[model samples]
Target: MKLAASRYPLRVATACALFGAIAVAQASVTQVSQITASHTVQQLAAAIDAQIAAPRFASSRWGIDVISLDTGRTLYAHDAGKLLQTASTAKLYTAALVLDTLGTDYRIPTQLLVTQPIVQGRLEGSLILRGMGDPTLDTPGTNTDWADQLAAQLAASGVHEVQGDLIADDSYFSGPSAGSGWEARDLQSWFAPPASALSVQENTVNLMVEPSRVPGERARLKLDPADAFPRVINTLTTSAGNTRSDINLYRAPGDMTLYAFGHIAAQSQAQTYKLAMADPAQFAGTLLQEALARHGIRLKGALRVLHWPQQADIGLDRAVVLAQVLSPPVMDVLTRGLKRSQNLYLQNLLQIAGVKARASAGQVADPASGFLTTEAWGIRALDELLGRIGIPPEDSQIEDGAGLSRQDLATPAAMTHLLVYLARQPYGAQLRDTLPTAGVDGTLQWRMRNTAASNNVHAKTGSMNDVRCVAGYVTTASGERLAFAIMLNNVVREGDEPSPSRTLDAIMEQLAAFQGRG
Candidate 1:
């Protein structure tokens, strides 16, 4: 477990720039004094126990583990192997498997295969879209303009008009539309868009609004990059003379029926809202029509989703092999997924793994196929990844890699083990940088402020009612590196407010300060 020593100077420089000269000088002067590994371990254990016995955390049912990166030894443990619901911490395992199996350079490919060639400015055959499950397909960022570019490619293929229908082939993934544990209420939320074989625009729609100038008239609402979803009726009422507003949108199951609730101030020029979809297929169809219109192409037939290409001759132009679009490597997604705890991104990564595993299984009679279901594939991939780093199977339970399911569980020991493994990877810098810096970004932006760990610790955070977990790497003032996991479950706070997440964060900061020097 040789730690990256050069990072010490760079991190110190950053700390100085962010926290002022006084803090950097203080952190630098704290020199590393010689101490035996066994003695340091004992001291760290006692200090962590003392912190746990403190009154602020007296009623918390939590687990903690500290491992010496210098010697691959467990310096401290508290119910470290107990299984508990991990919430988003499940992404750690998901990221590990993806990094190992897919490799850091693996980019998801979205294919454009030509079925027919243009003849007399008219496509005589059908245009087929074969999806490769790129989650960022329709994301709004500048680099994510691939969908529109793809439209351009189709136009350049010499098909001025499609005589046949525009077909979407989303057969790469074999599973249900959504994850089983996804909350019914959350399904209509942007973060819970339905996962599909072919996902576009992250499977969501953008609702925009502008206040009406006429007195007593309601605000005007419209969809951006419209024509993707079915007609949505905004039944939400706006109040007069109100300067502020709240808005809520709901979509019924099975049908694209939408309901909008909330308020907006009068006379506001513009605002943007996110609306989840109940049927992604219909939404994709609508968008395809709009995009095609931009390129002077219209479907003479209808929209269809099939397991394979249509057998009938629809007189569409022959599809040419346009350039294929590939997503950023697995490491890029992993960093954002774990550090930011993006549920959709993590879920997509898991599905990618499942698809890969099933493909490897080939045409076997066994339904499991080592990856038939998400759990089977996830567990196998996890064990295989950990085995490469010498972590035993008995150390953890990884059910659904997203940690959104209550069935997913892991111990403090296993969590820290993952951190250790990530630190040794060649792309370890990207992994560490992706995690939320203390009190600066992502979930940790508000946590560890004004503490030693404020910017010194970078870790993944998890929350599920009474469960709170933070696991990752922490560098001490003297440059000693330690990996730790502090998980609290079934905590009893004085009032019925959210569990004491901030208090747990404080304790973690204190734990980071324990350099294990006696």
Candidate 2:
């Protein structure tokens, strides 16, 4: 079912008009706190300071802000207006922008366009698989594989065979394959896949390895979605039973070759590792080819991908949509992605938003006429949205929506202010519900357990090397609603025995237990 107030742009514009005046217009990051507060507030602040001031974290920096939504008052703050690495917490901004612009009822759709009609059992022209960046294309439903569903749709459309080439068109989103500020070394990691418009299995493949019966024999490896995986150079050896399994998978910068070295115990169970693929359009095209072949559809031409700058001859006069599929509601997609901190989903949403941005202010919002990269357009849209809500551009430097880049920075005050602003809008509750509940589910399933914050604090958690951050809503022990953002940077983990998340969790517990002059 669709949500109420589903007219997206209209609602967003209305919100801008309604709250633009309430937005703080400061050009710099600066926190506002009560000059005098009750003892309860002081104790909460002291307790949080203790957690962040530990000797082990002396080298780290923190930015925190906690405000009572009930009274619109700041209870505690520490360098809240300072710029800090946001990590995955940046997803919250992407989520808010899309939710406001696209609405909860919006559904991303894919279309199969063709220039010629099927004649008796064959297509006379190319079959174009046009995508609009729906990230859930590869996810299976309750009983049917998504790929099989697409194949069935094509079959139902009387596509018995294709006499021409199969074209994967991802012109919907055009930008660098890598997000802004993404390092080359991270390209091969599963979490660092390209932000292509056509994504299959999140542009990743799982490699399964089995130990050989002999202690010295090389291990056998198999990659799922064999049609799109990179070449794996195997140097893995099997060890004796009861021995530990040690494996290292390496991929060089700008190269697709994977080097697998190390050993697995003969008694060990099969191991599965997921890694990123190089090109999403190619991977998607290959998967569709395999699916069509299984469905007995004959293809007489080669499979190819058509990205931006590569125009397709659609024969606009006779171009027809053969089949189309709509994703689940955009809000549902955002919820699933945030629960797992899936970076691509957020990035794709931002890309789509950019595609909607106009090349010039006089021109209307159009996805096709922009000269700049989709990434640039998206960042511009984000800046505009923040300005509408009173967040100065100086408070944040947003390179990518997912915050994979160390260059992504946002003041704790900005994050908290964003949360407070969203909480006042009609879709605020929906946005809040998408966040991970402490110690209950999503990325926070294991955190804040057995504490006052357990299952109470709803927030977005950000994680990356040397950075940890969180921001969202929580109701204190006295039933006072609050908005907060906490950032920790330059964190150095000591041997992995203890995680800095514990300190974050401690800070949250203090906030959860606070009982002020309510």
Candidate 3:
């Protein structure tokens, strides 16, 4: 990307610069699109060409790359140098940064601290539950929460009561409550939950919607934490008979007041929705207080969630570690982030990683949003990673880890560059195992099924309004491994032709079936 247009042909020079590291030009039709690599490579190119040339995507832009892992050759490419909207594919770079900076087995811990001695369950001035940004404090598939786990740990430590304020210290992360570049509409949704240092239940609250016993009655609303949201106005009612179930959730930025409306069918079973939390640390404190009572640890003081500049003066230098809970190994946690496209997980990871990089650089925060912003510092760190990976600074300009920011952009060549670099590392395969598998598991489970690529392709799938992308590894029929990236922007699925998603599947199908002699 540093090479200007006068020296490079639009996208060709940039892509070639990365691919050239392989010691061979891509399969050329004439050595420069003249002498092709082989009949199979030509066939593979033709199939992809057909997909890209489809009439439906005539107005869209594409960025693609298919490189053989067995041989560092670009088997197929089209506009691979273009910086297109990456959607969730941006998480790949975040995953790489995590592996490079913190190994796969690293664990994030949340600790319970008491600054004063608890003599005969007394003399405690204040108790602190400090969060170190472990997004998975509550293990998956368990009917438990982080507060419950840590509260139990505290009970195991012999302290039966807190003599003062129960503080949920979220000061570990130095930034505003929200992520940079997230829009107002996104903040109202669950996916844009705050990436706080002390987060629990992934910074989301689950609401159960069950139909009333009789028609025309208000539906039963059950909030899991019961106090996750400070207030809720539910206008949901059950329909008269068997019909569609429609439920809606809305909230204003920085407000914990939730608005729930719409009706469910009279006969429909209960449905649950995971909604965003306005204050994650507050939610954690509320839940912890309930857990403490359940564990017979009486809390004599009110619960509190302390953020930076709010409880910034809380003394913890000599705090005794009463109890703590560590998240699952980072690898396992990252698997859920990559596979489920969990926005908070990726954003939290980026935010916390930047916290470290900032500490290392002796910096605090950036005033990007007119206040302290850890996200900007995080972006700078990821940008440095891109530079270290040899990806051109011009090829990408990512603003957030979840790729939910409208300003996020990355090129297929850069995607493949990061993929290939990570693949060559000692923990390369471990990283690959985190991606969604084609037609087997994760986001790609329902895609490319019963085809050559089915169960054979392990990749990450990403999508947004007018955007779609799939990138990862696939095994060819000849037993060769290939890394690929297919990105589309401004896509509009219309007419009778297969949509871009199907076209991607079609392209992958041919790539899996290709028997290359090179």
Candidate 4:
């Protein structure tokens, strides 16, 4: 569905007319108890503080705020305007910008082209794989097997072996293959998908397996595309017990040797599991080569990464456009991106905006025209939205759109301000609908499991090594609506465990139950 607001500039302008004054009042109030004596509001704030002071979350530094959407009143706050690390909660801002700037109905496109024509039954030239940063491409079972699908698409076109090689055009992005600050350990994990112009399958393959025959022998490991480039060196020994089935996937530098180590099937029963890889491009290249060959397209040359020339590299036939595939609307992407906390999708979307940014006049469009090395674009866009609701830019420092960095910061007031702005927009309902409903889904799925907020609240949840944050809208029993942000950071910890998520849940529950005084 299309967003009700056409552009963020206009939306901000309209919202300013509606709640500009209310926003001013909300910016103050550093103490929760000092706010309105509404029994509901006071009790809610008190309960949340109790949780913050509890053993679990008491040691963490935090900022919090709750605002009345109806009256634009600040009901509660704790250093409400202070800056702090936001973590994945940063995606919330990214999402808002995408919704406001690109509209919810926008679809990312990935185009396919035939660089060569079919002379009789043979392909006389190369085939080009062009990308526009579509995250959905190469996802399991979505018919996104670019190689297999393209080969089939080619077979249907009555062409067999190609006289030339398959070419990949991924020059759209020019920088590190991965984002800055990405942990080295996270690279082998499925979550750290390589950011590339021509990415597929989320840039990783799934390895499924079960127990093998020998008591301490290696278990059976099966690759989905079997033809992919990842070569495994299995040193895993299996045993008889569910407790021993803990598996770990690893990759050594300069080698495709992926090692799996774990225990499985003590009773000789069956079990299922997965293994993820660090390099997806090599895997894609390997699979594409095999798939094309299966369709009788023989490449007489070796495949390598090279720049796409303005003209064909080989003396082949002329280039012609074939078909184009586009991704679902931006809102749909946002739903999954935010709900699943998929960093790849969020970061890719950020880069896409960089592509949309205007270059200096007469400078001509270069690689940096639409892309940025920092969070300036998202921050500038968010400032406009917040400013429309009377928020001051001095209140926060936004370093990353996904808030994955500790340098990123935001005040509780700013968070509530944003929520209020969304609440007043024509597409406010969409924004509200996208959030996790207490215990029902997304990051909040396992939280507030049995509380009144379980199904009543729709909110975003954020957490890091020592930080926990939540923000979004809440609908009370009396039908009164509220916007809130709860942030916690620098939690004191002995070792690994910083604090329990339950502490934040308890505080949120109390806030939800707040009722106004007579």
Any runs in candidate 4 off by more than 4 Å, and if so which?
A: 1-40, 116-123, 140-149, 152-161, 208-212, 215-220, 225-229, 238-248, 252-255, 261-276, 285-320, 358-394, 492-499
RMSD of candidates 1 onward, in order: 9.7, 11.3, 10.4, 11.5
Quote each prediction's TM-score.
0.78, 0.86, 0.85, 0.76
Off by over 4 Å in 1: 1-47, 54-59, 116-122, 140-142, 206-228, 239-248, 261-273, 280-285, 306-320, 363-379, 386-395, 492-499
The C-alpha lDDT values of all candidates are 0.66, 0.78, 0.77, 0.64
Alpha carbon lDDT of residue 132, candidate 2? 85
Poorly placed runs, candidate 2 (over 4 Å): 1-39, 140-144, 239-246, 253-256, 262-269, 294-296, 308-318, 359-362, 365-370, 495-497
Worst window of 10 by summed lDDT in candidate 4: 1-10
lDDT of 2 by residue, 1-518 (tens): 12121232233344354244224212211332212222387677777777788888889999999988889899889999999999999988888778766878988877677898689868998888778888777776511255566777889877889999989888778767778888765666677777778876787877788999899999998887785554678999999988887766666554667777788899789877666776678777777788888988888999888877777665645768777778889988898889888888888888887776644443854454447777788788888889999999999888897889889999999999899998998888888889999868888876666667878999999977789999988888778999999999999887643578767877787777777743
List, residue by residue over 235-298, the lDDT tens digit for candidate 4: 6667766554555556542345766666566555553322234444555556667777887767
Rank by TM-score (best first)? 2, 3, 1, 4
Question: Model 3 lDDT vs. the true structure?
Answer: 0.77
Across 296-391, the per-residue lDDT of candidate 3 in tens digits comes to 998888887888757456678788887877777888889989998998888888877777776766654533344445666677788888798799
> Which model is ahead, 1 or 3, in terms of TM-score?
3
Residues forming the 10-long window of minimal summed lDDT in candidate 1: 1-10
Which scores better on TM-score, 1 or 2?
A: 2
Model 3: lowest-lDDT 10 consecutive positions: 28-37
